[model samples]
Target: MSGSGAIVLNETVHQPTRLRIMSMLVSVDTTDPLAYGFLQNHLELTPGNLTTHLRKLEDAQYVAITKEFHGVKPRTWVQATAAGRHAFAEYLTNLERVLGVRARP
Candidate 1:
């Protein structure tokens, strides 16, 4: 939805960790792969916790995961889908408007 001067996101993406994950994905360019360990350390999540969250995101089609071997180790890389980016941007825009930082356009 359009707000003061930006778009807004629905309440569906309000969770802190999910938001952070989306934020981080938006910050990257190219297909720069990220390891599960990277997210684990960054998000301070246990393996199970991270997997559970990732599964939810994946089910929502907000993120994609690729499983492969990195040399001798299995690597899991995460990326946000186009839909995810749009939703996150909308959420931020709406949030900005709610915060009175933007005008509904």
Candidate 2:
């Protein structure tokens, strides 16, 4: 094993797609969830790809998904939970620890 410190990463949120998703979700006001279509477009991911990433985060209780129908049209919304934000913060700290340095930019 490498001699790196015992830094633990939230592997679920560490996935690139999921990282981007959580970043966007946390940046927004927690009151409103990002619309499914908007997230797909902004992340430049296909519906299926986004859904797969979302399912992982949802399972981790990091992302909340809401589904409803708008005049018979199905709509989905996603937001980062408080636990998600805390976990993301810890993830960053661990990453910095593993790097043996920290920079915010």
Candidate 3:
């Protein structure tokens, strides 16, 4: 716990990889889900590595994963949930406070 009223970072969203993933997801339109492969390639993360991070976010109810078949191939899609958006926003606020910065409008 943080003492002296210091701000504490959210462990779940504070991890570097998870933070990057959340940033990308949060920046996109909620209606448009990011493809699994796209995230992996853009982030330069291995499939397993990306999966591991995504699983953690999923467990925290911060992301939604969908698997479906397109043609004969399976595709995976991910999107930030409403709860995730709110959580990320709060995380940013806490981070700004800790860094002595102001929130964005």
Off by over 4 Å in 1: 1-9, 103-105
Model 3 Cα lDDT, one tens digit per residue, 1-105: 267887888899999999999999999998989999999999999999999999999999999999999999999999999989998998998998888897568
Question: lDDT scores for all predictions?
Answer: 0.78, 0.89, 0.94
Preferred candidate (TM-score higher): 2 or 3: 3
lDDT of 3 at 27: 99
| Candidate 2 worst ten-residue window by lDDT | 1-10
Candidate 3: Cα lDDT at 32:
88
Error of 1 at 62 (Å): 0.9
Model 1 TM-score, all chains together: 0.81
Best by lDDT: 3
Best by TM-score: 3
**Which of the two, 1 or 3, has more lDDT?**
3
Error of 3 at 30 (Å): 1.3
RMSD of 2: 3.2
Q: Summarize candidate 1's per-residue lDDT along 1-105 as a digit string, tens digits.
A: 544545445655678878877778777873675677888899899999888878878888888899999799888889888877787787887788677795657
The number of clashing residue pairs in each candidate reads 9, 0, 0
lDDT of 2: 0.89
